[model samples]
Target: MLVFSDLEDQSGIWEETKDLFASDFLYHHKLTEYNDEIYLDALDDIQEHVWNCGGGKITQYGLPPSRDGEKTSNVIRREKSYNKESLQKNVNEKMSLLNDKQRHCYDVVMSRIKNGCIFNSNGIFLNAPGGTGKSFVLNMLLDSVRSQGKIALAVASSGIAATALHGGRTAHNMFKIPLMEYNEIRTCGIKKNSELARLLQMTSLIVWDEVVMANKNTLTALDITLRDILGNNKFMGGIVFVCAGDF
Candidate 1:
């Protein structure tokens, strides 16, 4: 009766030891009419089991395997798991060295996320030249939000450029934008009630680099697709977009 979603939660220990964690969640909780106390207690037990499976508390689980057997890269995008403690440790080390300007930018964006005003703010753009540390700033922001258990997407116009970002994928690959030459209007490759659409709805932040390389059609396509998926007409379907590039 127990079921755990590999699609939404981060993959790693959670997936490896899902069998061990499921007995309680899929069976006991249902039998008890979905008791919170029981669920929390089970989580405690499951956490201990997960720790023991990894050779006790001292061992590290490390990163996930990079086997893209299906080439369904969405699995990685939808389930980006990071070592929260280790990620925080790394981000802190990086944050300490930021220049005053970088620090200011980080603080402002972090403030928006923390204050929960991101949706209200509409969007953000880290307008800077190549040497101005735009990528560093963006990485810090992504790490900050991710550490707080929020989803942040990283995309770029080019595959090579996307590699430098966290969970970064080409915007076309991730969004599934159509490549039609004769089309007057455009729509994304996302289908209704599909996994990509679900992920888009759940995403809290999107950081797209190399925006200048994309055309107005691409942006319009994204907006139209989002409107379709999110059922709204507002810009970017009311999601906060952080589009950047050398403009």
Candidate 2:
């Protein structure tokens, strides 16, 4: 049985358990012994509960997957507090650490993100060579937007570039951009109804670093997938896809 007292702990498992069984005390009582029929019954109940919570007929996966053969790792993470006041204060303090140029860039990005500039279907490319505090500004942008109940997808063209920011991953890894050399592989590895599609749809901003080095093929692949899922052919389907690089 999952630990009831630790439901609020940030781990994915306990959070999912807590979400599935709102009454921690009840689940605690239900788990008297391991492999007991009662325990199994409780498991079944929680599975059904999760399924029901997800709109009952596989709108998404918290329970059984919609595709039988599809494999997934449904990691349930407890989200950081989205208290705007608290986050704004923290962001302000972080801004103080930024140099003038960095602060200016951060402010512009923040304004655009908050005021729906991304809806214009034109992506922005910020160019600043190494040591211009590009990473600092990116971090600030991610934190500020994520704090205000928005999703910021951070990725970099290469593995090394990916490590510079929080929650960063390689563009290929995060967007499922395959390394195929031919244009025949048009769409990305994301399915319209899958969780990856859901994530892309939920994302309001995408920050890509080291764009100078990323293959054009890779970007094209991502562009195609975004268009398919977003139901439009415009840039990232009206989502902000900011590419940053410097000579």
Candidate 3:
């Protein structure tokens, strides 16, 4: 004979009581108890008064609203707010600065994007010594994708490197990959219904700068999480993935 003023307040026990029987009860009576026997007895009457408002709103436990406790909507908005015209202008200016070898790398990556690299194995690794403009080429690739009204994720293994790219974020922060040692089956901490998940689904390209510094397990965790969120078993959920570093 549990009593409550509002069902919403008892959301914690909602699922536990879903199967409870009222012993003998039916609607609009100020108190309705549900039991298999009573429910069957008053089936027709109960059907008349029953209407589905919708599923109860429950936030997933251990899930934060967004990365670093930021608002979910703010994260989503920031990802999509880049000006296509401005990005295109910046890309055009930067194009002329690329060396011949760098320009060739840029063309190869852009071709992958135009041809829908998601359906195929489109992964690139730029291995060169320092002072070779790896960051310059990575930035060019990011701008090209974003200028076309598509999402391009730019992340780096370290904070200093991440700050150099447009809209860049630390790889661990962006994907919620754990820092400590983890099992092979472990995935990132991203929830499927989270705002970060939505952004990942919409992304066309992912440029990881200084990727050589990241742990192998961190990369594997990202792979597992992306596949789960995007519902695609393909590598990195079919996003064009680029890894650039001196290693």
Candidate 4:
């Protein structure tokens, strides 16, 4: 039969048991003798419990049955604490600089980060006639994320507009996107190079400005090329894609 004492003492016991399970076969044999069925049952139960508690699982062998529950609980607590710390760090870093709207947008973007959405792919349609401070908002967002030690790449369809963003450059120059116009199959020959591929893989954020100017066909090609180059075009280094354009 299995037994648990007071919740607090049980929790403390688990912490110590977790270490024993890390190594030492004596505990493993003891577990087998105590209740093999419960032992196997606990593995799945603990995994689910930990996950529900916002903790991930780690596997280990040669542990006693008495230690399993405590070990799992401790691991779950530790993971939860660690994630809390990371989130606090990110928030504290951004708190001072972001204003209201920017803070809202930043929160939305950061959700992807917390949810493990790695392919920083997002389309921001800034539809407020020309000169509505859209550019200002974009710049602020970029600076905020960069200040948190993330790389932000800004690319625009036009050279002049790209320069206006201060730190931004032409999409062609930044991503090396082919200049082939839509419907012209062989206009821009495909190049088999790894430099741009590597950059895409490592880059955290890709801000494509003036996306409205990009032809549908060109956009399709760019998407396909990026998807091909990056094994998973979902999220790049926890980077977010913020596209600011006038439509």
TM-score of each: 0.65, 0.65, 0.68, 0.51
Candidate maximizing lDDT: 3
RMSD of model 1 against the true structure: 13.0
Estimate candidate 4's alpha-carbon lDDT, on a 0 to 1 scale: 0.52
The clash number for model 2 is: 0
User: All models: lDDT?
Assistant: 0.67, 0.65, 0.70, 0.52
Per residue, candidate 2 scores C-alpha lDDT tens digits across 1-247 of: 2222323333355335543443432332223333333333333444444454542332233333222222332311112223456556778787779877777777677666777654464578889878877787887887788777778888998888887866678988888876677565676788788767877777778999989897677787888889889887787776877789996
Root mean square deviation (Cα) for candidate 3: 17.0
Instruction: List candidate 3 segments past 4 Å from native.
Output: 1-72, 117-119, 182-185
Q: Cα RMSDs of all predictions? A: 13.0, 10.7, 17.0, 18.2
Clashes of each: 2, 0, 5, 6
For model 4, the stretches where C-alpha displacement exceeds 4 angstroms are: 1-102, 113-121, 185-193, 233-239
Query: What's the residue-level lDDT of 26 in candidate 2?
Result: 36
Q: Please give the range of 10 consecutive residues that has the lowest summed lDDT in model 1.
A: 56-65
Top model by TM-score, which number?
3
Q: Which one wins by TM-score: 2 or 4?
A: 2
**lDDT by residue for model 3 over 12-100, one digit each (tens)?**
45335433422223321113545443333232222222212221112222111222222224355555656678778888887889989
lDDT tens digits by residue: candidate 4, 5-89: 1243444454566434332222312233434343444444455455455544423222234334443332222212212344345
Models sorted by lDDT, best on top: 3, 1, 2, 4
